[model samples]
Structure formats: structure tokens, C-alpha cells
Target chain A: MKSLLKKELSFYLNNPLGYIVIILFAVFANFMFVKDIFVVGSASMRPFFDILPWLLMIFIPALTMRMISEEKRTNTMEVLLSLPVSETQIVVSKFIAVWILTLIGFVLTLGLPISMYVLTGQVGGRIYLPEVFVGYLGELLLAASFIAISLFYSSLTKNQILAFLASVITIFFLIIFSTDFVAGVLPPVLQSVLNYLSPIVQLSNFVKGVIDIRSIFYFLSFTALFLFLTVVDLERRN
Target chain B: MITVKNVTKQFGKTQAVNDVSFTAQKGEIIGFLGPNGAGKTTTMRLILGLIRPTQGEVLVNRLDPLAHRMETLQHIGYLPENNPLYGEMKVREYLSFVAEIKGVSNEEDVSTVIGQVDISEKAQAKIEELSRGYRQRVGLAAALLGNPHILILDEPTSGLDPIEQEKIKNLIKKTAKNKIIIFSTHILSEVEDIATRLVIVSRGTVVYDGDKPKRKGGVEKLFKKLVV
Candidate 1:
């Protein structure tokens, strides 16, 4: 298991993809911060928090698209499966590789919240540190679920683009369910039920400093469900 | 050190390998010969536990491949049909990575396998930068880790220059002195010259299995009569 993790980490670190994703993430995240704080002259990170899901909806798929599909495309999956390792170990290692990469990207956004806190302190204005920290946690949880979803799709196809597209469509729907467009189209009872399932709605509570257990549980269970499916898919293949 | 018994693999309605049975002991080079789509690779895959046989069993060093997958795989090293490699990684990096996963990452062991396969010069070069022959050598190097007792190679000499072919053939001969070597090849003359025994499969069945022919071109006559 350690060997597999080391090999996966080296693959991203040695190639340009890892660096490219991090750079793009830092730039886009800071751009959101500037638009929210500087352009609007607001003390809150509401715009930055709002834009995060869209960024991850596009980038998490790109991060995880190649995990298994590349191996299958090159016939290296045969070598991987033939090893003494179990199917579950392979799935977990891949998940950790992408999850950790996403964590690094999330950590790099510290500058936004830290700057907001410091600049607000300097001007004697109000910026809630607790809410900002909780919001980052929410984003990480959402990213974890997205990684798991992407990992499952990557296992189902040999084409990375197909995996990426599948992840985007699935996650896009999850985000869509939280929007007023979906609520407006449905009855109040159905809207409430659907909104409870939407990660965007669940995460909104965290961004507001609510720290609800249901949202955390939803993200965790969603991640576990997909990873379990990934293991089952590979187990069935061999 | 390897035994295959009554193994039949069915892909949908078509049989890929049909009721094949063979045994190979230590210090013998068994040539698995068959034309394309003749079930040679499929049989090798079964023996390596890459896929299961529909009916029957494969045992490597007396361990059932399906039931005791890890313990059985520990004694055997396999080079799959296509010789797939990580082209982005340097030769040494790729070799060491395989060695680590195989639990033979001791510095001496990795260097020895690399030296044995004659890939030391290309150690720093990326696999994509190497020629087809060198890439094959790197694959062989990966399989040779841990000094496994059984080596199952599917088409070990395919798509190589004569010089490269000769080197691999010679290496196989040298290594067969102490290991159970089962290699599949479609090239008749290549197998005829080196194999201690021949197992020829045609249309998913083994048509012949016995000692190598003592006379020149005798196996060719036998193959032509039996297979094509």
C-alpha cells in the first residue's frame, strides 16, 4: 500500500499536471477573493465561498480523471491487478492520491482568509475568523466527495475525458439541486427534500458558521458510497 | 514447479483455452507455441492469475493461484504479452518501483537484476526514450526481481531485432538452469533451438507436449503437421 502511494505521488510530482493544477487553483481562488473584497469593498468572503464549488466542479474531475483510466488505456492495469495487492488497496491508494492533492490546493487558499482577517483587523472592521475557517472545512469536505465521485467514474471508463465529463455532469446536478431554479420548478415539500440532498445547500450552513453535523455526515457518506462502488467495480472486473 | 490441469476458459460461447493440462519442473525451459489467437497468451494469463479458468486449476510451486493469490504470486514473475511499461519514468525508477512493490527493494537485488538484463546503461533514460528492445529489457528486469523460482513470459522475444532476440534467448537459457521457465512464442525456429520441452496449442487445444526434437527442423515438421 505504501509502495503504491509513493508511486502515485511521484507520478504527479514528477509530471507538470500537479504544478499546473495548483497554480491555476491559486490564481482563480485569489481572483475570487479580490472580486469579493476589493471590487465590492466588502469585509466578507461570501463571493469567494460562492465561487468555490464551481471551481471544484471543474478541477476535481481534472485531478482524478487519469487515476485508473490511464492504467487501463496503456494495459498497465493488467500489471497492477496481477500484483499481490487487493482491489480495495488499489482503490484507496488512488483516492488518497487525489484527495491529498486537493487538500494541498485547499491549503494554498489560506492567503485569502488570512488576508481578510488581517486587513479587517487593521481597518477595525468585522471579519468572522470562525466562519472563514469553517467555510474552508466545508470546501474540503465537498472536494472530498467530488474526488470520490470522480474516482468512481475514472474506474468505469478507459477514456479520461469521458471520466471528466461524467464527473462534471453528476456534480453539476448536485449543485443544481440547491439552486432556486430547481426549487422554483418543484412543490415546497419536494423542494425541501431535494435541497436536503444537495451538497450546495448542506455546505451553505457551514459557510454561515452553522457547523451542522448533517452536512458533514452527508459529505462523508457520499464519499464512502462512491469509494465502496469503486472497489466493487474492480473486484468484479478480475 | 508449475502445473495446469484441465483448464478451459470460455469467453462467452467461444473457448479461449480448452482442457489444457501441462506440468513443468525446475531447470526446464518449456516453450508455449501457438499462432495468433491460438490461446497461448490466454493460458499464460491463467497461470499468472491475471484471469481465472472457467473449469480447472493452475498451481505455481504447489499454491493454488486463485485461492492463495499472493503466496502463489510471490514465487512467480511474469512478463505479460504486450510488455507494458511506464514510459514516463526512467528505467531505474521504474525498476525500483516494481522492486519495492514486489518486496525486493534491497539495493543489491535491484542493481543485480538491472545488471543481469543489461539495462544499466539505460537506467537514467526514460522508458519512452529507449528503443523497443530496451523497453522489453526493462520489462524483463521488472519480472526478474526477487529472483523468483518460476518465470512465465508471454512472447518474450516478439518484436525485437535478431541481436536483441539472441540476447534474450541466451539470458533465458542461462536463467533456466535453476528456475522453471515457461515462455510463449509464435516463432517456431526460436523455440526449436532453445526449448527443453514444447507445448503447442492450436485452436485452444494442446496438440503436442514432449521433449525437444533432437534432429534439426524436426519440431518445425511436427508443428506444421499439428498446428498449421
Candidate 2:
């Protein structure tokens, strides 16, 4: 498992795509932070959290789009499956590699809050460090779940484009089902059920500094479910 | 030694391998010859535990492949059809990764296999930059890295030049002296040169399984007689 993780990490580091994802994600997130947090003069990072899920919806897919798909396309999955490693270990190792990469992107965005704190301290307002940290945690969990989903979809096909599209559609639905749009359309009982199913809704609780156990379980369960599916998919493809 | 007992695999309605049973002893080189889509690759995949058999069981070294999995795979090295590799990785890095996964802790053996397969010169080159023949050599080197007791190579010499082909053939012949080697090929003459036994499958069933012909009759003649 360690070897597999090391190989995946090395592959990502050597490829230009990994660097491109980091640079592009940093630029886009910072741009949004400046436009919404600085230009609009908001104390709460609601806008920042608002845009995070969308950014991750696109970015995580790009990161995981070729995880297993390209292996199949190149026929390297056969080589991998034939090795002295179980399917579960292979799936988990690749997931951890992509999750760490996503976490790195989140860590880089910490500069945003630091910049805001400095700017605000120069003036007269409070920094609200705890709220922003909580928000960052929420965003990280959401990104991890989406990455797992993307990795699972990537295993289903040899085409990266198809994986990307499938992930986007799935994440979009997860986001939409959590929004007021679905609540407004559904009856009282159905709305309650749909709201519970919304990953974005679960994330909103974290951004509000609540740290709900239900939300945490939802994110962890979401990730586990997709990872399981990825393992099963790889086994079938083999 | 590898033993396959009444193994059958089906992808929905299309049966890829049907009730295939064979035993390959250690130190024997067997050839799997068949037309396209005739279950050759499917049988190899089943043996490697890449896919599950729909019926019956496949045992490698006295343990069912599906039950033991990694343990059974540790003693086998396989090169799938088309020489699949990580195109983004350098030749040496990819081989090293395979070696690590295959539990080859001996650094010298890794280098020796790379040199033996003639890929040591291109070790630093990325797979995307290498030609078809070079990629095939890298794939072969990876399969040989573990010094596995069983070698399952699918079309191992498909895209090589004459010189490289001869070198690979000779390597296989030398290596098979103490290991079980099963490779699928369409080239009849190549099989004649390397295989000790032949198993021909037609439409998901083994149509021919016997000793290598002592006479000059080609695999095509046998294939026509069985498949046609």
C-alpha cells in the first residue's frame, strides 16, 4: 500500500497536470476571495464558502479524471491488478494520494484568511478566525467526497472526458438537492428527506461553525461509499 | 504449477471462456493460440485473477486465485495484450514501481532484468517518448522484474523488429527452462520455435490441447481443422 501511494504521488508530481491544477485552483479561489470578500467588504465568508463547492465541483474532477480511466486506456490496469496487491489497497492508495493533493490546495488558500486578518486588523474590525477555520474544514470535506466520486466514475470508463462529465453531473445534483430549490418544489415530508441527502446542506452546517455530527458522518460516509464502489468497479473490470 | 479446472467466464450474454480446464506444470512453456475474440485473453485474465470466473475455479500453486489473490499473484508475472504502461512515467521508474508492488526487494535483479530486456539504455525516457518496440521491452522487463515462477505473457512479441523478436524469443526459451510460461500469439512460426505445448481455443472453448507437433504442420492447419 505504501509503495502504491508513493508511485501515485510520484506520478502526480512528475506530470504537468498536477502543477496546473494547483496553480489554476489557487488563482481562481483567490480571485473569488478578492472579488467577494475584499471588493464587497463582507465580514462573513459566506460568499467564499458559496463559491467553494462549485470550484471543487470542477477542480476535483480534473484531478481524478484520469486516475483509473487512463490506466484502462493504456492497458496498465492489467499490469496493476496482476501485482501482489489487493484491489482494496490499490483503490485506497490512489484515493489517499488525490485527497492529499486536494488538502494541499485547501492549505494554500489559508493565505486568503491571513491576508483578510491583516487587512482588517489594520482597520478596526474583528478577525473571526474560528468561523473561517470551520468554513475551511467544511469545504475540505466536501472536496474529499467529490474527489472520491470522481475517482469512482473515472474507473468506469477509459475516457477522461466521460469521467469529468459524469462527476460534474453527479456533483451538480448533490449540490442542487441540498439547496432551497428542491425544498421549495417538494412537499414537507419529501423536502425533509431530500435536505438530509444534500451534501452541500451538510457542508453549510460546518461553515456556520456548528460541527454537526450528522454532517460529519454524511461526508465520511459519502467518501467511503464511493471508495467501495471504486473497488468493486475495478474488480469487475479486471 | 498452474491448474485451471472447468473455468467459465461470461460478460452478460457473451461467454468469453467456457469450461476451460488445463494444467501447466513448472518448467514448461505453453502457447495459447486462437483467432481474435476466441477467449485467449479472457483465460489469461482469469488466471491472473483480474476477472472472476463465472463457473468453476482456477488454482495457481495449489491455491484458488480468487481466494488467495495477492499471495498467488506474488509467484506470477503477466504482460497483458498491447503492453499497457503508465505513459507519464519514465521506463526505469515504472519498472521500479512494478518491482516494488511485486515484492522484489533485490535491487540487482531489477537492474539485471532491465538490462536483459535491452531497456536499460532507455530507462530514463518517458513511456510516451519510446517507440512501440521499446514499450514492449519495458513491459517485458517489468514482468521479469519479480523473477516470478510463472510467466503469463499475452502477445509478448507483437510489435518488435526482427532482431528484438529473436532476442525476446531466445530470452523466453531460456527463462522457461525453470518456470511455467503461457503466452498467446497469432504467429504460428513463433509458437513453433518457443512453445512446448499448444492450446487452441475457438468460440470460448479449447479445441486443441496436446504436445507440440513433431511434423512441419503449421498452427493454421490445426486451427482450421478445429475452428473451421
Task: State each model's CA lDDT, in order.
Answer: 0.87, 0.87
**Residue B23, model 1, lDDT:** 94
Mind giving the per-residue lDDT tens digits that candidate 2 earns over B1-228? 888899899999899999999999987899999999999999999898888899988889999887788899989888889887888888888888888888787778788998888787898999999998888888888888878999999999897888878888998997786899999988888888999999999989988898888767676677678887
Model 1 C-alpha lDDT per residue in residues A1-238, reported as the tens digit of each score: 8888888888888999988997798789888768656668778876788899999999899989999888889999888776677778888898898878888888788888787788889989869888888888898899989999999999999999999999999999999998989988999998888898889998998888778998999999999999999888776623
For A41-90, candidate 2 gives per-residue lDDT tens digits of 66667777888898899999998998899888877777888888888998
Regions of model 1 farther than 4 Å from truth: A38-41, A187-193
lDDT of 1 at A38: 60
TM-score top scorer: 1
Candidate 2 shows a clash count of 1
For model 1, residues B93-191, the per-residue Cα lDDT tens digits are 888888877888797888998899998888899999999899888888888888888898989889999999999998888777789889998778888
TM-score of chain B of each: 0.97, 0.96
- The CAPRI-style docking tier of model 2 reads medium
